[model samples]
Target chain A: MYRQPVSRLWWLKKRTYFVFVMRELSCIFVAWFAVFLMVMVFAIGRGEASYQRFMDWAASPVVVAINIVALAFLVLHTMTWFVLTAHATPIRVGGRRVLAMREARVAGRIVPAATAVRVGGRQVPAAMVIASQYAGLVVVSAFIAWLVLR
Target chain B: MTKRHIEPIVWLLFSAGGVAAAVFLPILILLFGLAIPLGWVRPDYNYLDAVVSHWLTRLVLLGLLVVMLFHSAHRFRYTLHDGLQLRWEVPIAVLSYGGALLGSAAALLIVLTI
Candidate 1:
């Protein structure tokens, strides 16, 4: 026999449930990012002028707003993902369980910082690279806030 | 094969995609969207273009596209089934996974052709 359906609002009953929903929703932005990368690749293939125009369009206010919102959602997704991973996968060493928080810390800090390392290359310090990411985040947030307030 | 057998494989792809997205997405957004445009990091168009056109980069991107799409498919499939309380699991799974496969093919077409 068929069972009665669960409420659509079932995820709202707990904070973790809500976070899980948000984490799942983050896939939309991840897909958007993939599309964005494809567009950039396409523009690059079309040559210099097209790439310039693509950059110009990316700089537009509408794109800026979308990016800011996407960043917020992405951050939420990343943080929740780390927390979930920590619990879901545990490592054991010599019959002792290793700390999942260690995994969380490395993932939260090191992986994101590696992007800065790549961007900075050999010329920039690791600290500087990490700092720049934070700085960029702050600057974008400030710009968004200004846009909202103005 | 049964539907039960496909679950773990789809999950493996989804997990791989999740790890990739978590690592790359934040940085890519910062660099392209905020930093370069805001003049925090000057974008070298020629250099960037050269990097994108490289064979290895294209391969990595293809992997990214496939895994990311599968990740999205699995997540969205569950979202529809559980969140929306949709009982039609078979069709939802087929549509979600099938759409993701189509997307992967589209990405491959673009990357290879252009």
Candidate 2:
């Protein structure tokens, strides 16, 4: 058995690998968000004065910029994870695979329908999985917005 | 007790954390990190305070914080291991999971206090 030698800079050797590395690196931003929220929670727990100070700190140009970048990476993380979920877990409806109909022929006429996106041998459509994840994100975000901003 | 036995548990935490962060972190970060801070949206302090003080909110926050920490830990662990090509598995796992545990404990304390 022979194993090919790989370099530590392999991630830099290709665009997709680089993207994968960036995806992995998104964990740092994720951790940062968690810590930031913890700090905010602590401030809120401490009362109005501390919470105001937190807001002021958060408003600083540097913090805002970092957060903007974090937001971008987080979006990437969400997207890649959702796509992976579609590939990894196949959904079943009524003990049958959930599929998005691509096209159906009726009476010698082609009728357009939902696009079918299958992952290898998996029966569930990738589009359906991705769509459901995004829908979930939308609903969750909307609820949070309502809770916070209402 | 054995490393084999611990592997599945760690993976479970990682998956839970990944799902939690993917679904929840984006919106939360957008709100607190960007929207509120950038003045795109204003959050009333009293109302926000009341929301945070709610028992359900505290519970949810605690759960999210714990899982998110674990998720970060697991990913960072692999990033160091395979990405950075580090061979020290024991130390890496210890630090990654240990930090997550500590963060979870702190989150629990903070949320309970709130």
Candidate 3:
């Protein structure tokens, strides 16, 4: 059973809800990673004494396990969460005409970069900007994992 | 083409993140398992920045958090709509804008506090 056709209680599905919660709230794990990074930065910025204390504090088994679990959750959540992005922004081609599934598929597959007169206003493709943002995110996330993992 | 397209860049950013998760998770889990007992991947390491003094590192952390935050918030907004089956633009608009605003504020707090 999916979300009911038209009722207010549709937003909450037990399974999807858990997955979304696991995914969305996994931001907390990323937050944990970021905070750890900030503290490390500040500690290093502060002094060797601070850095020593930081490592000593992190050496506890309980704390380490939590980060690991958080990392696992963060990874799973990120993948599943982003897959749903396609539903968020559907594209329409042509003037006031229905978007056929074939056209939608083609558009999604290829990176389109054309300035066309949209239904009401013209849409200019900013392909470069989008590319930069995604690249930045991937590089950044990967770099951090490398640092901590190493 | 006479058709307006959904910005492929958006999908690329989204799916790229997804793909990263796919590629990265196994490695993380493996490391976490390997490092868990050694005091390397500890819970408090979540606060590893306390020892780091790297500008590039902090910036990277910020980038990752911001991207993940926006990506999550944006997706969550739609999940609300699709799951709720809410057809009215007015309410959907309010919910999404409000959600984004709240999420952004929370992110700022997290960033600023520590």
Give per-residue lDDT, candidate 3, residue B35.
Answer: 55
Model 1 C-alpha lDDT per residue in residues B1-114, reported as the tens digit of each score: 226667657767887787667666776777777766666666577777667778877898899888988988877877786677786878888888898899888889778965
Candidate 3 lDDT by residue in tens digits, B1-114: 212453343334334434444334434444443354355565445344452325554454455444544444444444455444445745654554454356445545444544
What are the models' TM-scores?
0.73, 0.87, 0.43
Clashing pairs in 1: none
Ranking by TM-score: 2, 1, 3
Q: How far out, in Å, is residue A9 in model 3?
A: 11
Name model 1 segments beyond 4 Å from true: A1-4, A94-150
Cα RMSD, model 1: 10.5
lDDT of 2 by residue, B19-109 (tens): 7889998899889998887789988998999999999999999888888898899889878877877779889889988999999998988
Better lDDT candidate (1, 3)? 1
Q: How well is each residue in A45-138 modelled by candidate 2, as lDDT tens digits?
A: 8999999899899999999999989999999999999887776565554444343534434223343322333444435677997998999999
Q: Per-residue lDDT for A1-150 in model 1, tens only?
A: 996666889888998778778878887888777778788788888988998888888899988888887788888876666545444443222333322212123211221111111222123333453454456546655653342223
Superposed by TM-score, candidate 3 places the C-alpha of residue B88 at a distance from the truth, in angstroms, of 20
Quote the positional error of residue B93 for candidate 3 in Å. Answer: 14
Model 1 TM-score relative to the real fold: 0.73
